[model samples]
Target chain A: MSRYVLRRVVESAVTLILATIVVFAGIRALPGDPARTLAGEESDPATLAAIRATYGLDEPLPVQYLRYVQKAATGDLGRSPRTGLPVAESIGHALPVTLQLAVFAIAIAVLMGIGTGVVAAVRRRRPAEWGANAIALLGLSVPNFWFGQMAILALAIAYPLLPASGFVSVFEDPVESFRHLLMPATVLGTGLAAIIMRQTRSAMLDALTADYVRTARAKGLSSAQVVLGHALRNSLIVVITVVGLQLGALISGAVVTEQLFVLPGFGKLTIDAVFTRDYPMIQGVVLVTATAYIVINLVVDLLYSVIDPRIRVGGPAL
Target chain B: MSLLEVQDLTVRFRTEEGPVLAVDEASFSVATREVVALVGESGCGKSVTALALTDLLPRNASVAGAIQLNGVRPSPRARGRDIAYIFQEPMTSLNPVLTVGRQIGEVLKRHQGASSRARIIELLELVGIPLPGRRIGEYPHQLSGGMRQRVMIAMAVACRPKLLVADEPTTALDVTVQAGILDVLRNLRDEIGTALLLITHDLGVVADIADRVVVMYAGRVIEQAGVHRLFAHPTHPYTRGLLDAVPTPGRPVLKEIPGRVPVMRATSDACTFADRCWRVTEQCRSVRPVLEPGPAGHPARCWHPLGGKE
Candidate 1:
């Protein structure tokens, strides 16, 4: 187990470095000069030069990347070229909001997905299964941005159930933070929830008819016991895989939902940085995202081994 | 009194092609502590009969029959407590992700309550698994085919069920493994007084372990008798064909049962096995012979059953 952990950590470290390089190059490749954008077109050459030097934009591309990497190694993410605020401090604020929203979305997705999937599988061809399937279809069909817009219109403008646009620290006010997070989280989660439901339902359908499930039934287990204990337990590997894939999609593409709700998460920060050509801030956001993806995958692999002993510790699958 | 009595059990599956009769009017019984072998080839509906005993057939199937255990209708609660099943292909039959101990523990816990770990080990040992302690933590993939079948046996007998219905239990094991499995089953029958409804197409298996034999052909019980009487007399043409198919020590050429079991779209009064029977006649073609006492002195659904004098 330790050896497997060590290997995965090392591989992730290498991938992280590669990701940083890609992001650094990608930000540089965008049209328009960061120096010009910050200094304004009316600024003289001297002002542009000064702005460039302040953010290390005047340096060669490799030197700038190396300096950025060096600073990142020491937890210094530099300053935004557009706003001149410390990138790390800005991220320190935005990261929590995005993380909280993502966590909420994932939890909601997993719970609803597995719950409805179980219902559909157990009820089978009954009306309950049809209802669950119909709901899952709607969840998958609607676009996230459209869903988020609809939610804002209904909950904020029409009903006034929540504030239309805002930011609140979960620590500062838990209820308000939840109120702010709920609509956007649900909107973001719907797509993933549908995918998970589809996967779970199919996997469970198979497990229900599996030989072991028959054995469990022959053992005099109640329907509840058979479905939950024997069938659902075996179907978890597929659900876990779906969760991992959907989670990756969530972290990387939660931008649209964040934009609709104006949640002031990394999505907003990264988008603003792109429009204004804030190279350092964009790089910082991308770094955080890449690290998160790696960690989430590692956690998923661990979960697999936990559920199925045959997959444990990189040993021969016994 | 019979431990299990199944009367006129009929199973029909509603497929896209239309309703098909899988098992028709199949009747058999197992007396307390007796071994009754339900013998047939694949698609002969023996497995359907076994599944029908527990009402475990898939949703598409409609079963009409009377099944009673100990002279009373077996409730769903009686499934694991009173009647247990050991299906074919032990590797797939046992849950792969579960430890050998936990899988057996499930039965012990469900029918009973709070199954102790020691009890699981005891069940494992009962089926002849050595080092039950070490084997407890291992998954199904870790064990050999015979060992897994033993685990299956252990699970089936966990509640000391009155009747254990095993569907081709030993058919999936090696020749060497088959004997060990039969031994475990025989021991369970002898020691615990559990009636066994053994389903198999192998006459060798029936001869080795069965006290009574029920022969099925094309979804009907063609013949049934004491194992010795059936072996010696060989009444129905289908039963004789089945017996002849088994290879003997000096028989250079083994006989084979011709043709396949037809998929019955409509259950007809016509003899279903006439197409494949050697002794088929005009009356046999036009009529479904009632399985009744005849010159052979046991029930056979054949107009001209072979004499028992041989």
Candidate 2:
């Protein structure tokens, strides 16, 4: 197990290095010049040159990349040209909001996904299963940005219950934070819920037909115990994988939903950095998002061993 | 009175090509403390008959006729408490995620409330699983195939069920392990006085453990008699064919049955085994043979019986 963990850590480090190289190269490959963007468009050539030299952009690409890697390793992402603040500080500010939204969305997705999946699989031929399947299809079909706007129109305009386009820190006021986050989190969760539900349903269908399920039934366990206790636990290995992948995706790719809801999250930060050619902020966001993706997958791998005793990492069967 | 009685039980499955009769008009009973073997070759409906006993067939399969226990029809609620089923593949029969103790304990808890941990260990010990205390915590894959089957048997007998239906229980085990599993099952029957309905394609296992043998071919019970009687003086040709097919030690040549068991059609007039039977006459081909009584009141389904003299 320790060997497994060590190997995974090494692999994650390699992935991070590769991701940094790609992000750094890709940002540089973008058409706009960061130095010219930082300086006024009408500024003299010498001023732009001075800005480029100061940021070390005038140096060769490899030297600049090495310097960027060195600075990033020490937790110093160069200052954002837009706000003149350290990119690390700005990312830190935006990360909590994105993490909170991701966490909430995933919680909602998992609960709804597993619950509906179990129900659908257990009462497979019944009307309830049909209804759950239809709901899942709708969840998968609707766009999150469109759903977010519809929620605002229905909840904020029609009902006047929530402020649809703002975020509040949960530490300051828990109730207000929940109220503000409920719509966007749910909107972001719907697609994830659908994906998770389909995977869970198919996995559960396979599990329900397993020989062990018949053994459980032959033991006089109720249908509830047979489905939930015997089958659902086995099905969760598949659902967890989907959750990890979809959760990471939501954390990094919720830019449009954030824009629709006006949440100042890392996704929003990423979009702003991209348009204004803020190299440091863009690289920092990509690095953090990629790291979160890797970490989430690693955590999921650990969870597989925990949930299934059959999965013994880095060892032959006992 | 018989502990479990199945009368005229027939199971049909509805598929895209319409219904297929898996088990047709099969009838048998297991008296108190009796080991009744339902023996047949593969695809002869032995396993389907066992599944029908516990009402565990899939949704597409429809079962007809009656299954009564202690003179009363057992409901689905009474299925596990009174009758339990062990499947062919023990590796897949035991839940991979649950500990051996938890799986056994669950049955006890459901049937007999508040099943303590001590009871789980006792059940494990009953099935000959070693180190009952430590082994109880291990998962299914941690154990060998024979050990996994022991866990399955432990779960089945946890409730002290009146009748245990084992569908080809030891077919997946190696030759050496098969004997030990059979011994454990025999011990279970002797100790608990639980009636055993052993389903198998192996005639050797039937001779070893079964008291009465019900020989099935093409989804019908073709012969039913005491195991010793049936082996000594086989009444039906199909039963004779089955007994002949078993390889004997030092035998010059093993006898082989002529053809495969044909799949049944919805409206068939011909005998199921006529195509495979050596004595396939014109009367046998055009008309189906019904199960009729033979000498000593043994039942054999054949138009021409192999009488003791023959």
Candidate 3:
């Protein structure tokens, strides 16, 4: 087990490093000059060159990359062009908002998806199963951004029940924060919930018909005990993998949802940085998100052994 | 009264083609403290009959006829408490995630509340599993095929069910392991006065453990008699064919039953085994023989049963 954990940690580090290089080089490839964007339209050539030298943009690509890596490794992500504050500090503030929203979205997805899946599997071919299937189909069909826009129009503008275009910190005011987060989180979670629902239903159907489930039935266990205790636990292995995948997607690609809701999240920050050529901020956000994704997957992998003893730590498995 | 009485129990599965009859008017009974072995080749409805006894067939399957346990028809809930079923593959029958002790305890707890841990340990030891203290804590995969089968036996007999239906219980084990499983089953029957419905295609096992044997061919009971009587004075052609197929040490070649068990599209009045019977006559082709007493006073469903005087 220790060996597996150590191997995973080293592999995660290598992955993060490779992701850092890609983000760094990829952001630099954008069709805009950071120095020119930093300077005003009327700025003289000397000021532009000085600004370029100040940010090390005048150096060779490798040299500039090394400087940025060294600064980033030390928790210095240079300065935000618009705010004139440390990029790390700016991102740190936005990070929590995105994390909060992602957590909410994931919670919704896991609960609704697993619940729907279990219902569908248990009452198979019944009206309840059909209803769940229909709901899952609808959720998957509608794109999340489109769903968010429609929700804002109907619930915010038309009904005026929600504030459609801003965010509030939960610490400052919990109810308002939840109110502000509800629409966007639903938009992001519905699509994920649909995917998870499908996976869970299929996994559960397989598990429910498994030989052990029959044995449980033969043991005089109630239907509830057999389904929940025997079938659900076995089905969770597949659903957990989907959960990890959806979480990574939620954290990394929540740009459209954040933009629609006008939430000050890392997704919005990283995207705005791209338009304004804020290379350091973009690299910082990508690195953090990638690290989070890698770590989440590692945790999921470790959880496999805990859930199933057949999959032992550093031992043979069927 | 017999511990279990199944009368005209027929099972049909609805398929894309149509409804197919899997078991046809199968009647069998197990008396108290008796082991009645249902012997047949694969796909001869042995497992289906056993599963039908508990109403455990899938949604596509429709079962007819009466199943009475302890002289009373049992509800779905009472079925499990009164009659227990063990499956063919021990490895797959056990929940891999749960420990052996928990799986057995679960059955005990559900049927009888709050199963004592010591009782669980006792059940394990009763099945001949050594080190019941440590072995109960282990999962199914950690145990050998023979040990897993023992655990399965332990779970089946947890409630001391009146009738235990074990379907091909030792088919997946080695010969040595097979003997051990049979010994455990025989001991359970002798000790608890539990009636057993043993399902296996292995006649050797039936001869070793079964007091009476029921032979099935193509979804119908062809012959049933005392184990010794059936082996010594077999009547039905199918039963004789089955007995002949068993390999003997001195025999250079084991006789094989010709053709396969027919897949019945429609349950006809004509004999189903006519296509594969060596003693089949025109009467056998045109009419389905009813199960009746022969010269040896054993029931066989053949028009011209072989004489019992062999």
Candidate 4:
């Protein structure tokens, strides 16, 4: 298992390198001159050139890439073109907000999804099943952005129940921060919850019909015990996979929701960077997001072995 | 008195097409200390009948008639520890994520509440599993197929039930492992005196283990008799067809019961085996023969049973 983990870590490092190259290349290819944008239209050619040189844009593409790699290795992400502050510091400031939203969204999704799915699967042909399925359909079909706007309008504009715009750090005021974070998290999480609920219901349905479940029943176990004890454990592997996939989307969605709520998170930062053509900020966010995605997947893979011993840690023993 | 008496048991699944009969008024019994083999091809409803005894049939399935276990009236909500079931695939029958000891321990805990860890280990050891003390902590995947099957048997017999219903326990095993599993079951029966209902398609397995044989054909019993008598003078055309299909050492290539078991499109008022039986006649197609004695203690369900003038 240790060897398997070591091998996976090596593979993950290679994947990370490839991802970095793709993001770096793709950002560089986009039609925009960060130096010109930073200098503004009124600036003279010499001032633009100085700005370009400062940002290492005057170097050849290969030389710039090599510098980016070297700096990235040393945790130096340069400075935001718009703010002239270090990009790493900006990211650090924004990351916690994104993390906070992602965690809350995921928690909500899992709790509601698994709960609804188990109930629907057990009830099976009942009206509750139909209702659960319908809710899942609604969740899958409705766009997150649309939902976010709706939530803001309903809770912020219509009812004035929640703070419509701006974010407060939980460390500053836990109660106020929760109140501000609640609506955005719910908006982002509901869609994922519906998906999880639907997937979990289907998985539970399949697991309930498995031969082992029948064996559990034949052992004189109560229906609840059979469903909860035997069926749920087997169905959890699929649920965990869905949860892992949604974590990336949740982090991405936090950006949109953060913007709607006026939260100074990675999403808003990235959007601002895109508008101002802040190459350093954009590149830094992309690298961090990509790394998070890869790391989460690795964690989930390790978890699979823990959840189900059947999954061999390493390749089959040759 | 019989340990289990399944009288006129019929199970029908409500499909979108119609109500498809899976088990057609199948009647059989198991006496204490007796192993009755419910022998049939796949889809012959042997497993359905076994499941119906414990009300373990699926929700779509509608089962009718009486299933009495040791004079106790059967109910859908009745505890099933009195009649345990061992399924065909052991790897699947035992929860893959759980330890073998815990799986067996669950049955004990459920039925016999507060059972000690030592007792669980003893049950594992009883099933001939090695390292019972240490192995109990290991998950199902750590165990081999034969070992898994033994764990299943251990789980089934944990409650010391009156009847153990083994549905093709050795069908998923290699020939050598198959004998070992059968031997374990036979020994368990001898030790515990728990009546066994062995369901399988293998005639050789039945011949080797069963004291009585109940042959099923397309959801109905075709022939039933003492193991020796049935083997000596196979009656129903379906039973003879099945026996002839079994490969014998130094004999000609075995004949198969050509074509699959008919998918019951409509209610089976006509003979279920008419399409496949070589000796099928107009009368065989017109009237579905009920199980009746062809000789003392031997029942055959056929219009013109073989080796009979009745």
Candidate 1 chain B worst ten-residue window by lDDT: B301-310
Clashes of 1: 0
Better TM-score candidate (1, 4): 1
Candidate 2 local lDDT, B1-310, one digit each (tens) = 7888889988888888877888888888889999999988888899888888778888899889898999898878776678987888998898888888889888888888878889889988999999999998888887889999988888888888889888998999998999998999899899998899999989999999999999988788889999999998788888998888899988879898988977665636777888788877998889888888876468898887887444
Of the two candidates 1 and 3, the one with more favorable DockQ, higher being better, is: 3
Candidate-wise lDDT, in order:
0.88, 0.87, 0.88, 0.86
In candidate 4, the residue pairs with backbone N, CA or C atoms under 3 Å apart (3 or more residues apart, or in different chains) clash, namely none
Question: Chain B TM-score in candidate 2, rounded to 2 decimals?
Answer: 0.96
Tell me what fraction of the real C-alpha contacts between chains A and B each candidate also makes: 0.60, 0.83, 0.67, 0.75
In candidate 3, what are the lDDT values of residues A1-318, reduced to their tens digit? 677778888998899888888988888887877777889777889999998887777889888888887888899988876678889998899999998898889888888999999999989989999999999999999988789989999999999998997889889999999999988888899888988899989999999899999999988898899998999998888998999887867765478899889899988888887777777777777778888988998899888877887775443454
**CAPRI classification of candidate 2:** medium
- lDDT by residue for model 4 (B1-310), tens: 8878888888889889877888888888889989999998999989988888878888898988888877877654444577888889987788878877788888888877777789989998889999999889888777788998999999899888888999999999999999999999999998988889999999899999999999988888889999999998998888888888888888878888888987675555678888988888898888878899875458988877788564
In candidate 2, what are the lDDT values of residues A268-297, reduced to their tens digit? Answer: 899899888888888899888888888888
C-alpha lDDT (0 to 100) for residue A300 of candidate 4: 85
Candidate 2 vs candidate 3: which has greater lDDT? 3
- lDDT (10s digit) by residue, model 4, range A253-285: 787788777888889888888888888888999
Q: Report residue B219 deviation for candidate 1 (angstroms).
A: 1.3
Better of 1 and 3 by TM-score: 1
* Tens-digit lDDT track of model 3 for B261-282: 9877667878888888887789
What ranges in model 3 sit over 4 Å off? A40-45, A58-67, A314-317, B308-310
